[model samples]
Target: MSLKWVDVQEIAIQLVDSRPGVDPRFVNFVDLHQWVLALPEFNDDPRHGGEKVLEAIQAAWIEEAD
Candidate 1:
């Protein structure tokens, strides 16, 4: 499935798998945004994501990490 910025949960899951042992809690939004854009499955407007979306992804990633 194509991933947009709104697919925060899926993005988080992918991040968790791609970045093992990395702590999402300490990640900045800028890096997170770049990381999401770098995902092979991600296909959406680069300008679509905002701080809120990034936060949601981070939260989901943190949860997945646990």
Candidate 2:
């Protein structure tokens, strides 16, 4: 499933807002991905790559709003 840039931005912002100690500027997906990757638990997640994490977030978002 393809994701729009705005959608990615929105999701990233929401995630950043929800998490503790996350900077608001990390709404930028690339930065967000890099930040997330640094977290130990994320190493075990299948969506390890930046693109995959973005895609997975989009997919989960679609499922959640339905």
Candidate 3:
């Protein structure tokens, strides 16, 4: 399944799986944005990922990490 910026939960899941042991709480938005773009299943416009979307992704990632 392809991932977009709207797919925050799924992206967070993928991030948790791909980057094990990494704390989402400490990750910056720039790195988070790049990481999402780098995901093999991700396919979306980079511009679509604004601060709100990134915040949602980070929140989901933090939850998934717990």
The candidate that achieves the highest TM-score relative to the unseen native structure: 3
Runs of candidate 3 exceeding 4 Å displacement: none
Winner of 1 and 2 under lDDT: 1
- Candidate 1, run of 10 with poorest lDDT: 46-55
Which pairs of residues have clashing backbones in candidate 2? none
User: By summed lDDT, which 10 consecutive residues of candidate 3 come out lowest?
Assistant: 1-10
Q: How many backbone clashes does candidate 3 have?
A: 0
lDDT of 1 by residue, 1-65 (tens): 89998888899999999989789999998999999999999999988888888989999999999
Give one digit per residue, the lDDT tens place, for model 3 in 5-59.
9999999999999999789999999999999999999999999999999999999
Q: How well does each candidate superpose onto the true structure, as a TM-score?
A: 0.95, 0.34, 0.97
Per residue, candidate 2 scores C-alpha lDDT tens digits across 15-39 of 5445646444324557556554543
- Candidates 1 and 2: which is better by TM-score? 1
The reply for model 2, stretches above 4 Å from the true place, is 1-18, 21-26, 44-52, 58-66
Predictions: Cα RMSD each? 0.7, 9.0, 0.5
lDDT of 1: 0.92
lDDT of each: 0.92, 0.49, 0.96
- lDDT at 54 for candidate 2? 66
